[model samples]
Each structure stands twice: as structure tokens, then as C-alpha cells.
Target chain A: MGHVIRTRTRASTVAAIVGAIVVLGLALLPLVAGRGLIQDMFFILTMLVLAQFWNLLAGYGGLVSIGQQAFVGLGAYAMFAGVILAGIDPVWAIPLGGLAAVIVAVPTAFFAFRLAGAYFAIATWVIAEVVRLSVAQWKTLGGGTGTSLPRTATRDIAGTGWIEAALDVRGAAARDILAYWLALGLALLAIGAIYGLLRSRRGLALASIRDNEEAARSVGVDAARLKWSVFLAAAFGTGIAGGLIFMQIARISPDAAFSVTEWTAFVIFIVVIGGIGTIEGPILGVLVFFALQKLLADFGAWYLIALGVIGIAVMLFAPRGLWGLISHRTGLELFPIRRRLITTKGNDHG
Target chain B: MSILSLAGVSKSYGSLKVTDDVTFDLPEGQALGIIGPNGAGKSTLFNLITGNVLPDAGRIAFDGRDVTRTPPMRRCLAGIGRSFQIPQPFDRLTVFENLLVAATHGRGQGEAAVVRDCADILERCELSARANDPAGGLSLLGRKRLELARAMATRPRLLLLDEIAGGLTEGECTALIRTIRDVHAQGVTIIWIEHVLHALNSVVERLLVLDFGRVIGIGEPGEIMASQEVREIYLGIEI
Candidate 1:
């Protein structure tokens, strides 16, 4: 029994060390990369956030909602409203967008939770469309033509003497590098939060519901409540990603803000490529996906088609996903939510 | 005093009556066996008790409190734990994680205690070896063990086992029966729905034979098995 405890302690210590190293490495990347690379990194980080959100919803909660773009658009628009209308700082707008998404998610979850399986998926899609159409008809937020953050405001912020003063020693590349670091920090925080949530009790309930709704209910899991919590969380996460995407591009349009095809498709691909239901899978999947995108940038539309093909292939061959297959072989999980017993010679009481 | 009482419980789908005026009382810590052939509403009865299905017409009381309309989770929190006929472990979760969920959320246990109880339950179910393995990869016997482990994790005063021994081999069934006996010995009231007569006979003292949603016989297991009406409806040819 002592030997077993010792072994488990040693294993957990090693896992903790590895996790810390990985996080620290990610945290420091912005200090090393160039301006263009930093911007690209920011985009990747945003993608990672979306992937994690989708994974939590479909992968863990068994809520395969295609309408997550509703919140994505809502978040972008929230940023627009915050900065341009409400006069809130653009950076602070991200969390506001997340909060707005949560507010919307409650009613959406109420309506969507009534349906199950395919019907639930469809209801979410319909909800997204309703939001999209409503926003599209609103003449004030650049209904169809799209909206752009005022260039004057961008120039005013960029011209801040403090940024220039700081970059004087490191050159213009330093400012862009700082932005990259900010994006990377956000991504890491999002991933870490998800990791923590998944290791909590609520995560277990979500997993049970995902596996078998009826059985989960029989065991006293309130499937509706759990689903609602996950829905709001997912919406909050996706909305933050949208806010970050807009910050990187310095613009937001109704079509672009709500573009399900771009953000949702990319997120779905990342989570699918990585193992769904595992915290680290989406991060690894995002890294691989970004690598492929960079390598095949010249392929244009073919790049998207290739991505689709790769997603299909991954699903067919490794339904558990690439990270899932690797984890199966290595038996290494950075976020170890489950326990295992190691029996010793004298531990035969069980 | 009875911990649970169901009176005039009836459930129907369109024209078919799944539970027909089924009534029973479960005194605290009493083991009740529900035996019936296929489609005899044995599992449905358990569901009604746990509030999985609201009766079309009936009243249910738990600890003398009217809970006829209480949700499943509330019932579970009130100390009712049930296993599915087909063992449905959270496929993406490890065996230990699966039980930990029931312990924490279903029973509202603290995290450390939940972990301790989960480990103990896993050990008792002989699943300690495969505790870290994903639930989907388990064998039929392993799944059955997990099903029971999860239910026990809830720390229920009343447990409903729905054909947990159905798909297990004879050896596996015996092992399961022993584990269940140990649990029952701990004073956890059990209502088991089993087609496996031997397994039921070994564990339960009283048997309620159900057919077409009504109790055909209610007595000691051997006496109920030997009843003429129960033989005609459930036993049919032999045993």
C-alpha cells in the first residue's frame, strides 16, 4: 500500500512539472517572436479558444451546437458597441462580450434544452439564425456593409508615447511582440480555466450526461441544468475568442462577426483533429492546424478543401482523435481528472 | 415506518399501460426483489419510484414526504440510487471518474470524501485494476461492475438494480452477487429487477412477481417461484 501511494505521488509530481513547463513555455513565446509572427500567434490563440469552447460543448456535454457563431457574432458586436458606443476600453470589451453572451445563452439554453439529440442541434442553429437575421436588419451597426473601428482611435492609441518610448530600445518589432504576448496570455488563461473546470465535479456530471442522458438522469444528474451551465460557459468562451479576433483585425462586420463558416469550421476542425473530451487535445490540435495552414497558405480554397478532407480522415481513422490515439499509447494526461488504484502484495482486502 | 410508498401508480403510452396501479411499500433498509419476464414493467417500476417517469395516476412518498412530482435528481439527493438495465458508464470517463461523479453530484459528498468513497467502491467492485481505463473499453462484466460502483457511489439508502447480472457469465454473476450481498449486508435497502432467478434467489428474501404491470405473486422467493399464477405468466415451462 505504501509503495502504491509512493508511485502515485511520484507520477502526479512528474505530471505537474510537465504541465508547468508547457504553460511557462507558451507564456514566454511572445518575447521571442517577430511582429508578423506575433500577429499570426494571436490568430492561433483565438482559434485555440474557440476550439476549447466547442470541445467542452459537443465533446463533453454531448451538445453538438452548430450555432455557436451566434455568440461569436454577439461578442464581436459587443466589442464594437463597447468601444464605439459605450466608450469602454477595447481590451475590457472582451469580458463584457463574454458577459453578454452568457446573458443570451440563458434564454437560448432554456429553449434549446427542451429538445434532445438532433432536435437540440437544430434548435441551436435556428436560434443562431434568428440572432443573425435580427442583427442583419438593424441599420445602425452597419447592417450589411459591415463596421470598422475608427482609424483615428487606432492611430491615437498607436501613437501613445509610452509604446514608442518602450520600443525605442527593442525597435518597432517590440510593440507588435507585446500584442502577441497579450493574445498568447489570453489563450493560455482560457485553456487553463477549461482544464480547471473539467477537473471539477461539474465536469464529471457533464461527462455522464454526454455518455447516456437517460442513465445520467436515473442517477440523479439534472441534465437540463448541467447542459445550461455548459451552454453559457461555451458561449462565454466563444465570445471572448470573437473579441480577440476583432482586436487582431481592428474591424468587425455583421457578416464577418457572425461568420460561422470561418470561426466554427476552424474550431470544429481543431477539436476534431485533436481528441475531443480531453483538455489538452484541443491545444495540440490548434498547434497542428496552424502549422498546416502556414505551410499550405498558397493553396487558397484548396487549403480549406484539404482541411475538410483531413478532418474526415481523422474522424474515420481515429474517432477518439489524434491526441486521443497518442494518449492511448503514452497513457499521459496533463489534466488527470480520474483516479487509478495501484495494488500491492498485502492489499488484497478489496 | 416505510421509507417509500407508492399507491395506484399507473403509466401508459398511448394505449399500452406500462405500470398498472402498481403499489408497494419499502420500509427503511428493506430488500425487495422485483421479478418478471420481458416487457413486464419491472424496470419501469424502478423508474417510477426514482421519478424517471411521472405516473399517469399515482402518489409516491419518500420518508413520508409527498414526492410524486419531484425530479430524478432530487430523488437521487433524497437517497435513491438506480442502475440501468444496460450499463451506461460515461464512456469518455475513466472508471474512477465515473463513480466520482455520482459521489460528488448525486450524493453531494465533498471532493476528498468522494474520491475516498469512489476508490473504496471501485475496490469493492473489483474494478481497481481498470480504474484509470476509459469506460468504453471495459468488457461486459467490467461494465456491470462499473454500473454498480456508480450506483453505490451515491451512498443511497435505497438502491435499484436493473438486471445488472443479465449479460454476465455464471462466474461473473456469482462474483457480482457476492459484492451485492456485501452491500446489502451494510443495511442499504435494495430493489433488484432480475431475470436471472438464481442470482435473485441467492440475494433477495422476498420476491414480487410482476406481469402486465401488476404483481402476480408477492412472497418469499421460493414460494413466489412455486406459485401457479406466477408459473403460468412468468415461469411458463420450467424452474
Candidate 2:
């Protein structure tokens, strides 16, 4: 029998069918749901996008960077600079944020790749702080105290008027729905792109490097190049998510843009709680994270303590994350990366 | 002409030199067995040749091209493959996937070529039954086989085997000897550092002895075994 490498399972096929339908259902939520619900989804979807990019960087790329907020804050700042200073439309400026992040990633990779382990993690945090401090000095975008987009710019964002008419909602509610949809699209794209990359040949090389870096070099895998590329890609995607997120909120500040606790720490928690390596893990992780934020966000300092407690519990018990626990019990993988050998009927003829 | 040549290669950590001015020649398709007492720098010699460790004073030429300064990956891509003294397979990957990485990256084989070559390798290494299992789950013999299989996947012109038969039982050692013999028959040059004398003798015609990071004897396997100085240094015989 001839071998055919297969990663897709019957369960995965079924999961994809159900998952597609579910995403479609989510897309139509703004039609029937209240503005508050739409706004909540915007938060959840953007966090999912941010979390997925972080997972791809740390989980698959073997680069555990704590400075992801550097990109988020930079992207948001770029979006603001594009709209307020350059007179570009806000919708058009969104992609400019992603581009700005990618441009910054080149220099960041050179410095970051020089250090490893805890030193590398700390180096990233330091760099992020530097970025925050630097951005705070930009007087054009409102210095240390921070600034918001112009009233006209926020009010005249592309598609808001069209969304208001189509959804039969007021202008404000329409903006919320439109931003919610953008978050949903970004979330799907992030997951799909990561899944695709992890299944490719480069993904195989990346896995080997993560498994054993020295051994990977012995087998001719260029560890440095692969790590650099994954880092830049994660930065690019994170920047876009950051831009989209801030655009929805219509405000920006150096501290708010580069908040490590809000962006990086929470993302790490989601991936760890849900399962860092698997794509399905982040979905499960983000859902759990969003639920906790909504339900207990106002319990004062106790809420932070509760989040810490739950994060530790999942990490200690599950280790692989919530999706890991689910996969272990049910043997189901919605986004499988392992290849299986199957025998084909035409093997003998060949 | 030698397929691999090492001249005056030396390395030291502080004052303790692991390899001191070591020099050797390996002709095409020749199988040379290296036997040394513990801490004799036999494995260090292998690392130097494979470019995992650079020599302080030496020239290494593979296929008549100098590769002393090349990095490990470039040396690997240039057709030098070696197994670790301890197996270092990617723990989370399946056995087939480990080989797939080597075949693609080390040998630069395309997708279809890698698949076909990997199947043949798995069968040759007697790992087809466990190809789908994680490398970490393999038995001792299985892990050793994987180490060899991955190195072989690179399609090396010069293969270095480090203590491959060290911990195997007699029966397993015999199987490994046969595998090594088959590999030699395929015209790939081999330099094996082994503690298992019987296993080394069966596959290699030439034997080189080392002591205190210096070569003590180099000749036919029987001649090296009969040398008086080799007996004193390696076997600790008074004669």
C-alpha cells in the first residue's frame, strides 16, 4: 500500500461544517442583538485575533515574546497618525497601522533574536516600554496625556452611513455593528492563516526547531530565519487587530495602547488556559476569558485574584489548556496538524 | 583520494584538550571504526568532523572541499550527516515526520521524493510499524534506529555513527551490524565510534584507536587489535 499524508479527520470535517455555520450565525448577531451585545462581541473577537497571533508566535515559532503590546500600541498610534495628521480616512488608515507594525518588526527582530529564554522575554518587555515612552513624546498625536480622533473623523468613518441605513439602526449603533463585523472578519482570517501556515512545510521545520533547536540545525533547518519570519508575521497581524480595536473605541493613549497587562498578559492567559499549540484552543480560551471578564469584571480587586486563581488552576490541571482537555477526552481536533499515512487503491498500478 | 580528510584538528576546554592535533583520512566507501577508552575524545572527534564543534587548529575537507568553517546546517546540506551519541529525535513529532524534516532540509528533496524516500527508510530501519508513534514513545532500540534513520534521510556521502551499538543487546547489535554493512554496501563512507568491539569489527575493515585525545593505532581491524601499544592503552594489558 502506498502512503498518503492526511491531516484531516472525519471529526474535523464535521467540526468545520458546524464551525462554519456557527461563524455565520455570529455574523448575523448584530441584526437582532442590542448595541451592548455587539460591543461585547467586538471585544471578544479582537482579543481572539490578538490571542491567536500570540499563540502562533510563542507556541509554534518558539519565540515567547512579552512585548506584543509594542505592536498593538504602535498600530493604534499609526492609525491615529494616519487619520488626524495625514487626513487619511479612518477605514483606510486601519491597514496603514498593520503596515507600520510590519515596518517596526524588522528592527525589533534583529534585537530580539539576539537573546534567548528569560533574557529574551525581558528584552522584549524593555523594548515595549521604550516604544511606549517614545510614542508618548509625539506631540502631534497628543503627548503624554494622550488624545482622541477628531469628532468629524469618527463620525464620518466609511460605511457607517451605509450600515445605519441597512441595519435600520442609528448612526452610533451602526458604527458599533460595522466595527463588530470587522473584528469578526479579522478573527476568522487570523485563525485561517495560522492553520494554513502550521500545515505547510515551513510549519514542519518550525515544529522541529521548537522540539529541539540544535538538532534542527543538524538537519539543516535555518532556525534564525524561521523564527524571524514568524515574529514579523505575528507583529503584522497584531498591529492590525490593535488598529481595528482602537478605531472602534475612537481613542488612543500611549499607556492605553501599550498596556502589557491588557494585551500581552491576557493573551498569554487565554492561550495557556485554552491550549497554546492548537488552533481550537484559542477559541475555547477566548470564550472562557470573555465570559469571566463580563461576569466578574466589576468585583473589584477580587476579580483580578479570581482570574489569577482560574488561570493557575487550568495551567496546573489541564497543562495543554481547555481544548487540550476536550481533545484528550473526545479525540476530536477541529484544526488538526498531524499527518496520517493512508493507502490508496492506485498504488500498485504506479 | 580521501572523501573526508582531517589534518591537525584540535579543541580544548580550558586546559583539558578533548581533541589534540587529531588527523585522519577516510577514502570513498571506506568504513573506519574508532575505539577509545572513556573520555578519550572519540565523540569529540565526530563533532569536529560534523561541524557541530569547530577545531582550533585543523583543516577538514569533505568531497575535496574545505568545510572546517561551515556551520552545522551547511555541513549537513553539503552531504555530511552524523547521529548523536544520544538519540535526539524531535520528541513531539511522529517518527515519519522526523525523517521528513531531514529529507527535505538536509537533502533538499521535494515533497514526493521525501515521501517515497521516507517509506523506504522506515522499512530499512525497521521502524515502519511505529512510524505513526511519537519519537518520545519509542523503545531504546527504536530510538537508536530513529537516530540512524534520520541521519540516513539526509543522504549523506560521509556518515558518522557515534556509539550506535553501545547499549544494544548482542542480538540487537547483530541487527545493527547488518544495517551498517548494508549502508556501507551502498557506497556511503562511514566513520563509526563504538565501544562494542564485536559489532564494530563485523562492519568495519579498518580500526583506529585513541587515548588521551591522541591516536594510538591505525591499521586493519585485526592488526590494530594485535598492536602492543593499543593493548596497553585500550585494554590495559601489561604487554
Candidate 3:
């Protein structure tokens, strides 16, 4: 037992160090890369965030919600409203978007909680469509045509006017670099937060509830409360990712803000390929997903088909997923939540 | 004091009655054994006691508090810990993780304490050697041990065992009986439903028999076994 604890502690320490190094590398990437690459990296970082949140929800919480796009669209609109109408800064808009997503999640959870199993999944998808339609119909925000943020030359060019007027051209690059760092920082925090949560008591309850709801309830776990909490957290995380996405693109429209196909597909692919239920799976899956996307960009529609096929194949052949399969074979866990007694002390302890 | 009492507890699904006007008192620290033939609604009685299914017409009192409409989790928190007839462990989690979840959530214990309690339960259940194995991969005996470990992790004053020794070998059943005796000595109340008459005979002093959702016999295990009603309904047939 003592040895198992020591091994787990060592593994966690190694994971922490690796995580710090990855964060540092991401923080420094914008400095080394050109503006285009930095922009692409920002997009990928947002996708990583989305994937991690979805992975936590469906993979660990067993929610399997298809309507997460409701929060995604809500986040985009919240950012747009915060920046354009409320006169909030772009950075502050990200959290405001998350808050708005939470607000929407409250009602969504109420209706969605009434369902179970496959019905719940389908209900969430319907809710997302309802939100999308409602948002598209709101004339004040652009309705069907969709709205655009004020992109004055001052805002359009990265760090152009005010910073340039204050110092030299280097100042503008510095500001853009700061924005990239901000996105990277948020992504890392999301991963770290999820990792910590999965190691906490609440995470264990969620896992128990996921694996066997009947048994969990029999043991005094409030399944509804845990499911709702995870649902809300997932919405909040996806909302933040949405805001980052719009920030990277510097625009928001109904169709673009509510693009479930892209966000859901990418996140589902990442979790399915990397491994569901492990904190490290989303990170690894995101990296592999982006690598494939970069390599197959020229394939256009085929690229998406390839992603779908891969996801289906992985689900069929490797239900444990890549990380799950590896962990099964090697018994090496980076995030060790349980202590296994390696050697029995025999009748003494008994 | 009676920790739990059921008064005229009746439950039905559509036209079929599963638990018919069943009444019993579980005094604090008492170990009660329930025996019945297949389809005697023994499992349904366990479910009703644990609040998995609401009693259609009855009153359930736990620790002198009414809990007829209470949810399953609430009943669990109020000191009811039950295992399924077939072992149901969290398939994706390791044995230790499964118990850790039960310890933390069932008793609402903090992380460190829950961990300690989970380790202790694993050791007591003789599952320490396979603690790291995924629950889905466990053998029948291992799975049964995990089911018991999970229930024990709840730190319940009342533990309900639903046919836990059903599929085990005679030797395994003896081992499990010994474990239950140890737990009983520690002052935990137990309600065991088992087809293995000898297993219950070894552990429990009192026995109750059910048939067609109604109590047919209740007395000391030896006397209940000798009763003509019980023998004809359950024990007369070959083992």
C-alpha cells in the first residue's frame, strides 16, 4: 500500500512537471511564430478547451449531450454583446460569456434533467436547435443575417493605432503577443482545473454515478445534483472556449457562433481518440487531431469524413480509446486517483 | 430501539404485486436473514427498504423518522447500505476507486478519510490483492467482494446483503460468512437475503421466509427451517 502511494505521488509529480513545460511552450509560441501561425495556434487552443470540457461531461459524467452548442452560441453572442453593446473590454468579455452560458444552462438543465439515457442526449440536441433558432430570430442582434462587432481600423489591425502612437511598431506586436498568451493561459487553466477536479471528491462521485447510476444511488450519491453540476461546468467551459474562438477570429455571426458541427465534431473526435475519463486524454487527443488536420487540410470535405471514420473506427475497435488501451496494457496512470495495495499483509490486517 | 420498521408496506407494478403488506422491525444492531424461493419478491423487499421503489401503501420509519417517499440516496444517507443480487461495480473504475466513491459520497466523508476507509474496507473484504484491477475484469468472487466492499465503505449502521453468496462456492460462502460475522461483531446491523441456507444459518440467529410477496414464516433459523410452511414453500425441494 505504501509503495503504491509513493508510485502514484511520483507519477503525479512527473505529470505536473510535464504540464508546466507544455504551458510554458504554449506561452512562448506566439513570440517565435508568425502572426498566421499564432492565429492558428489560438484556434487549436480553443478547440482543446472545448474537447476537454466535452470529454469531462460525456466521458466521465456520462451526460452524452449533443446540445452543448447552445452554450457555444450563447457564449459567442455574449462576447459580442459585452464588447459592442456593453462597452466591456475583449478580455473581460470571455468570462461574461461564461456567465451567460451558465444562465442559459440553468433552464436547459431543468428541462434536460427530466430525461434519461438516449432521451436526454436527444433532448439536449433539440434544446440547442431551439436556442439557435431563437438567437437567429432576435432582430436586435442581427437576426438571420447575423451581427458583426465594430472592427474599426483601430480594432481590425493587431496592436496598430494606440500602441503604435504610444511607442514603436514593436508595441503592436507585443499587444498581439499578450492576447495570444491570454488564450494560452485560459486553455492551460481549463486543463489544470479539470485535472484538479477529477482528483477531488466530486469527480469520484461523478465517476461512480456514470459507471452505475443504480448502484451510486443505492450508496447515497445524489445523481441529479452531480449530473447538473457537471452539465453546468461543461457549459461554462465551452462558453469560455467560444469567446476565445470569436476573439481569435475577431467576428461573430449566428451561423458562426452556433456552429455545432465544427465544435462538437472536433471535441467528440478528440475525446474518442485520446481516451475518455482520463485528464491526459484530451490533451493528447487534441495534439493528434490538430496534427491530422494540418496534414490533411488540402483534402477539404474528405478531411472531415476521415475524422468521422476515424472516430467511428476507434469507438468500435478500441472502446477504451488510445489512452485507455495504453493504460490497460501497461498499468501506468499519470493521474492516479485510487491507491492499490500491491502486497497483502495477510491475516494481520484482516 | 428499532432502527427501521415497515408498517403494511405494499408495492405493485401495474397489476402485479411485488411486496404485499410486508411488515418487519429491524432493531438496532440486529442481524436478520431473509430466505425464499425464486420469485418470492425478496429482492423487491430489499429495494423497497432501500427506497429504490416507493411503497404503494405503507409507512417506512428509519430511526423514528418517516421515510416512505424519501429517495434512495436519502435512505442510504440515513444509514441503509444495500448490495445488488448480481454484483454491480463501477465497470470502468478500479476496485479501490469504486470503494473510494462509496466512502466519500455515501458517508459524505472528506477525501483523506474516505481514502483511509476505502483501504480498510478493501483489506477487510480480502480484495486488497486485486484493488488495482478494473471492476469489470474481476472474477465472480472478486466482483462479489467488491460489491460488499462498496457497501461497507458507506459505513452504514444497517447493511443489506442481497444474495451476495448466491454464485460462490461452498468454501467461498463459508469465507463470506466469516466476514459477515466479523462485521456483525463490530455492531453493524445486517439483513441478508440468500438462497444458501447454510450460509445464513451460520451467521444469523433469526430467519424470515417469503412466498408470493407475503411473509410465510419467521422465527429462529432452526425453528423456521423446521416449520411445515417454510419446508413446503422453500426447503422441501432438493438443494
lDDT of each: 0.80, 0.88, 0.81
Model 3 alpha-carbon miss at residue A29, Å: 1.7
- Preferred candidate (lDDT higher): 1 or 2: 2
Q: Give the alpha carbon lDDT tens digit for every residue of A89-161 in model 3.
A: 6667778889989999999889988887799989988988898888888786788787666654215343445
Q: Which stretch of 10 consecutive residues in model 2 chain A shows the poorest summed lDDT? A: A341-350
- Candidate 2: lDDT of A272? 93
lDDT by residue (tens digit), candidate 2, A1-350: 67667788999889899999999999999889999999989998999999999998888888899999999998999999999989898888999889989998898888878899888899899999999999999999998989998988888689999988887998779888889999999999998898888888888898898889888999888888899889989999999998998998888999899999999999999999999888988889999999998899889888888989999999889898999888879878888888765456667224
TM-score of 1: 0.91
lDDT of 1 by residue, A231-327 (tens): 8888998887777677557777777887778777788889999989888789889888999999889999999999999999999999989888987
Candidate with top TM-score is 2
Report lDDT (Cα) of residue B137, candidate 2. Answer: 94
Off by more than 4 A, model 2: A348-350, B236-239
What are the per-residue Cα lDDT tens digits for candidate 1 across B155-194?
A: 9888999999998889999999999999999999899998
Q: Which stretches of candidate 1 lie over 4 Å from their true place?
A: A1-32, A158-161, A169-178, A342-350
- Tens digit of per-residue lDDT, candidate 2, span B106-149: 97766566787787888899999898778989988998999999
Clashing pairs in model 3, backbone N/Cα/C closer than 3 A: none
Of all native A–B interface contacts, model 3 reproduces a fraction of 0.74
Interface RMSD of every candidate?
3.6, 1.4, 3.0
